[model samples]
Target: MFDRHKSTPAFTRFTYFTFTYFTHFVRSAMTAFTLIILTFIIASIFHGLTGIGVTLIATTALASSYPMSHVLVLTVIPCLLINLVVFLDGGRIVYYLKKYWLLVLTSFVGSFIGTKLVFIIASHHLLIALGLLIVGYVAMQFVAMSVGKNFKLPNTTPSLVISGTIAGVLGGATNAMSPLLVMYLLSATEYTDDPKTELIKASNLCYVVGKIAQLIVL
Candidate 1:
């Protein structure tokens, strides 16, 4: 008599393969999700301390694997909320707005324009641009530290306009403007009693504005 259970059916092998594939897929997906969350947490902590790292950290860290467009989308909300919290944490909203109204206006315009370009550009190009932006910022920081930056810009209309527009465009395009704004505020407030506060306030203000621009365009 032929043994009825002697041989495995093809369906058994197919079912085994499917189950293995599904299990592996689920595990891999969970791992990726966890790592992404971990990256965001680290970035958030750094931003809380420095008032600038969320975008810089997230953008550079995730850009290699994820499309820059998706990374920016992930970044836009958290960055906005963090900046709002930080900016409000210090208070004096009236003072900051009054002082930086022009800066805010110019940044809004530049950010809006820059954000519009994001949709038109290719994802790979945007990724490359973001990578270069981070690298350039790091290089500039190195130069500033090693060579000792001494020149100071007066916080005049011209300086504020230029800085605000550039920072806004940079923030809008790459979602990392802290490097430029940090350098700018440090240079401009050589005589302020509380330079650190000024930096937090100014940078957060610009960041908030740039985020608003991004949100509007998006």
Candidate 2:
């Protein structure tokens, strides 16, 4: 007995609701995109001044808008992947394997120990304190150009072992270890007035490997 020509109001209302939902979703996505761009710009400014600043800067920015634990978890894998790519593509791996196999091996062993330590630490404040101290010391060194004069490094096997072990311990305590690693390397070398290009490259290699190993262990 119903009229065959009658339009169904339910179908028309559903179509209108779906369209409205999609429109709102698109607007929200655009807003998020804008926010991320702003964060990247701020991070980039830090990176320009110091190579190690980007991660901290970006992490801070993300933490401002997201949960700290969530941001830390999200950043780990991508940072690891990026370091892997740079280590491989930049010939750093080949350089270390060819010229500094022992350094690489010792660092690997140390990194394993460090990774275990990270699990033992209940609070993250120690790591933050260490990171701040490292950055501060480096900044002071940069301000005083003559500070590295007469820096003599231990150049024996036993010394290398001890250095690696201590570096490993610090690395375990903090997510960062490059500052300690570099200082140890410099102390062992008599690099005054000589081109230290190779030494610089080797230090970078250590950092790359240490970071990658941390990523794996953590």
Candidate 3:
């Protein structure tokens, strides 16, 4: 099925270039796969410790190959599955929901609005917004770490609403709202004593609720 032909200089050059391009593509794809695996491992560890970071880490890793919008969608199933595991593991879902119903409801509404906006807004603008939100989340986390457990927002309706809304918007836009929810939970007075446990519980709940809202809206 093969025919032999004399190779010209141009043909030689084309063959070399094609091989080089193929090699590079293979290497790049392998590198991305390896990084994604590593990111998943690290994110899982962080999730176990803090009930957050899986979406953020996975998004950061996969953004190399996909658009932010696609990354957000790709993360939904994984986030929902992981959050469900965490939420069930933590147990007492009813108690947390009853205690933080306002936050949950506000977050759901905010997420609903955010999901709608994601469809309306330009992709580049959404990418810009996602980048800013991630940076802000990192800064807030740093501040919380430096300030310690004593630094807390009042556990009032307004605070909960604001935090939940912000979390919902970010979550809806990027699927990376766990950090904000964790921050809000950690800073709330209700979780002051055993913040780690409460943080995991509330953060997982928020993530589950946010992911569900995104699923419905998207």
Top candidate when judged by lDDT against the true structure: 1
- Each model's TM-score, in the order given? 0.84, 0.56, 0.76
Ranking by lDDT: 1, 3, 2
Lowest summed lDDT window (length 10), candidate 2: 47-56
On the 0 to 100 scale, the lDDT of residue 46 in model 3 is 85
The whole-model lDDT of each prediction reads: 0.79, 0.56, 0.76
List candidate 2 stretches off by more than 4 Å: 1-95, 128-132, 139-152, 187-195
Could you give candidate 1's per-residue lDDT for residues 1-218 as a string of tens digits?
A: 76556555766887999999999999998987887788889988998888767777877777777776677787789878988988899589998888778878888887887787778888788777777878887787787789897334456778878877877887787776766567667766567778778778877888898889998988
Pull out the clashing pairs in model 3. none
Q: How far is 127's C-alpha from truth in model 3 (Å)?
A: 2.3
1-218 per-residue lDDT for model 2 (tens digits):
87544656766777899999999999988986677667666755654444343444555556555543444444455444443444454464575567656666677678667666655654455446554756776675776566755333476677666666666555444535455555566654444343244455555455456556666766
Model 2 clash count equals: 2
How well does candidate 2 match the true structure, expressed as C-alpha RMSD? Answer: 6.4
